[model samples]
Target: MSRFMSAALCALFVFSMTTANASAADAPGKAVYDINCSTCHKDGVMNAPKLGDKAAWAPRIKQGIAVLTKNSITGFKGKVGMMMAKGGHPNLTDAQVKSAVEYIVLQSK
Candidate 1:
C-alpha cells in the first residue's frame, strides 16, 4: 500500500476510536441510569421528571447536587410525587444511586 493510503487508514482508525471513547466518557452514569432511572424518568411517570426537562429540574438543580444525590439515595417525598429509596432497587449502592443522579442532573441541565 502507498504511504499516503496507510496514513489515511491510521487516521481514520484513530478518529473512530476517539469518537467511541468520547461518547462513552460523556455518560459516566449511563449504566445505572438505564437500569434504574429510565423507567420513570423517561416518561415522567408519577411526576418523576423526564430526562431532559430543564423546567422540571430547575428547582431541584437549584437545590444543588449534594441534595439531589441524597434524595436519590434516601428517597424523596415531594408535593407532586415521591421517589423510592435507591429507586426501589435495594441492591443498588449509594455510589450507584449517586452516579445515576449525576447522570440525570447532567441531562436535565
Candidate 2:
C-alpha cells in the first residue's frame, strides 16, 4: 500500500480505539446500574431517587459525587429508604459501586 494510505489507516485505527476506550469506561457503569441501581432508582421504589429525576437528584448532586459515592458504598438511611452498602450486594467491588453511582448520578442529572 502507499505510505500515505497506510498512515491514514493507522490514524483511523488509533482514533477508533481511543473513542471505544472512552466509551468502554461508561459501559460497565451503565451495566452495573442496570443490574443494581435501576430496580429502585428507575421507579423510585421506597423513595429511592428516580432515574432521570433532575429535581430529586439536584441536592444530592450538589453534595458532590464524592459524598454520593461514599453513601452508596457505605450505605445511607434517608427519609424514604435505606441504601444498603453496595446496594446490598457485598460481592461488588468498591470500583463497581462507584461506577454504578457515577452512572446513576449522570443519568439523574
lDDT of each: 0.88, 0.85
In the range 1-109, model 1's lDDT, one tens digit per residue, is 6999999999999999998688658775887899888999999899888999999999999999899999888899998899999889989888878888888888898
TM-score of each: 0.75, 0.74
Runs of candidate 2 with Cα error greater than 4 angstroms are 1-26
Q: Which candidate is the best by TM-score?
A: 1
> Cα deviation of 98 in candidate 2 (Å)?
0.8
Candidate 2, 24-76: lDDT as tens digits = 66586887788888888888887898989999899989999889889988999
What value does the lDDT take at residue 61 in candidate 2? Answer: 92
